[model samples]
Target: MNDGPGGPGDQAAYDVVVVGAGVVGTAIARELAHHDLRIAVLDAAADVGDGTSKANTAILHTGFDATPGTLESRLVRRGYDLLEGYAAATGIPVEPLGALLVAWDDEQLAALPKLKAKAEANGYDRTRVIGADEVYRREPRLGPGALGALHVPGESIICPWTTTLAFATEAVRAGVDLRLSTRVGEVVAGDGDRPHEIRTSRGVVRARYVVNAAGLWSDELDRRFGHRGFTVTPRRGELIVFDKLARPL
Candidate 1:
């Protein structure tokens, strides 16, 4: 991993340059390294997974609730199996504790079957709709009148930090240049076979192809290349830590 700034004489271009060192960025870099390509990963943070990747809920979703026929649904379903196997082989901590989509009202109760059907459409057929009695039976610490719940048995929790670190470590071992604390500024288009010049805080990085995995700032980066297909709106979520004594619940 080359975490230092590039010198003036460092003019060698890369085949692919990933814009972030988060989980998605590192994963892309690691995958690209298998193709014998010259890859580089750049991040504004001092270390890998220092952004939203470390602050997520760390759930390995089954795509059970994802909208059917979407690219996200397909990728999530495929990624779940891939990540599960990778975690097993790489010693990444994972707990297959599953999840429950609880329904507290009659309207929500009526939607459980639809949700189950949606899960089935997304190629996940393990979801079962259990009544309130079964819900309380599985979770005895219930405190209200729950109608029913969609028991998604494929949902699992994982250690996001270890996962991202593993990808970055593997990519670095595979000769992918990792540049930390390098913030990309402007992107200059290249003509013909010339490499695209990416101006960063430290120096200019030339690459044949550039990938944007900047998370919240992805839209801003896309506009640099004259793309306006989508916009990113940041949403705040709260993470509550419970004592280990409440693990049973």
Candidate 2:
């Protein structure tokens, strides 16, 4: 794994270390390129995007209703705008297929207006309630119990594969050292005041700063740093993708 330019015990130094090569991690690495810093992005997989990043529904989130003013909301909104422009710059595909939140019964139907109001509160004012006739017209194959639906026009599908790859490729081309499969096993302090030394399966690696974006393994990494700030409950979702010819929506 570490058999690249530097062999075992080479103990090379990097200005910054960004863990994980998911879309978010790669973007951080790319953003660091503006500074004259030696950055290294690490991943446990043999290739990038082989984790939860590869799976799940491929929706480009609008982050509407993300509590409006928190870090999550801010980053998601910024990432949405950034990725939108990036998709245009590159050739990544995105289909603006609006979503229809169906209401199957009277109780569910009563929730439509509230959902629309919530969307408005979330700075997404495009959502509105559609009558049954229009709902049936839009989705001809909808189940018989649907009374109405809330139309969210900003929802869209995206190609997450290219999104992650684009950030990784650009970061690598911009001189970010991408260390693959070099799993960090332990951390050793350097000279009682120097950068933290990461002991990996390959050898010792040093970094002045570290950004932990380990996703599911975030807990394990926090323990390695002697600080259990948070723990993770990894949940995996399974989606069955019908063939493109199956239907177009």
Candidate 3:
């Protein structure tokens, strides 16, 4: 809690409690600070970005491949613009390197036009179906039997580490109570006209509202509060990493 004027409460009762300190979690906390509310962001790790947020493919989604008019599409598009600007301002490493949907067969080569249409449907007009000659010219290191591809030039790579850290740090600097290694195991709702009591290893936390952002284990927290509408279904996307010099064959 910041001692600055109009800061969050310095007492035990927080106006809002947010679990998890990942990129998404910290962003929520940061946005909530614009309002007159006491927000506490908690993380189980020793520090923020120690979770899955620190890993995975560092590619920034252009919302080009995303389904049109979907929630993820809108957020990813807005988030792309938001992060691109934020990354520039905060010195977060980001390279807007274009990607080629490499094709090695006739079927995939035929997919280029359809994929281009899909990109147009998603509000991305820059995507185009390039010829095999242009494809090879763009990615000279591509493997043999390669055909044409759908070029999405907006895709970029970003530093996921700095992105999460930046959000968490900014939110902390903006008057958020960031608690590290503090895990809430149980939540006992107070009776009518009383604050909710959350039991953690350190002590009990009494808060007016609570948000569960605990990536994989968010559902468990929701169960304690007798709220069943929310369920956490983990979705895993696995990919193989490669250095710039490593070419597929």
The number of the candidate with the highest lDDT is 1
RMSD of each: 1.8, 2.3, 4.1
- Candidate closer to the true structure by lDDT (higher is better), 2 or 3: 3
Number of colliding residue pairs in each model: 0, 0, 0
Worst 10 residues of 1 by lDDT: 1-10
TM-score of 1: 0.93
For model 1, residues 82-171, the per-residue Cα lDDT tens digits are 999999999999999988899999999999999999999999999999999999988889888988999999899999999999999999
lDDT of 3: 0.82
Candidate 1, clashing residue pairs?
none
TM-score of each: 0.93, 0.91, 0.88
Across 112-178, the per-residue lDDT of candidate 3 in tens digits comes to 8888888888878999888889988887877778777888899999999988988988888888888
Per-model CA lDDT versus the true structure: 0.91, 0.81, 0.82
Residue pairs that clash (backbone atoms under 3 angstroms), model 3 = none
Q: Model 2, stretches more than 4 Å misplaced?
A: 1-9, 189-192
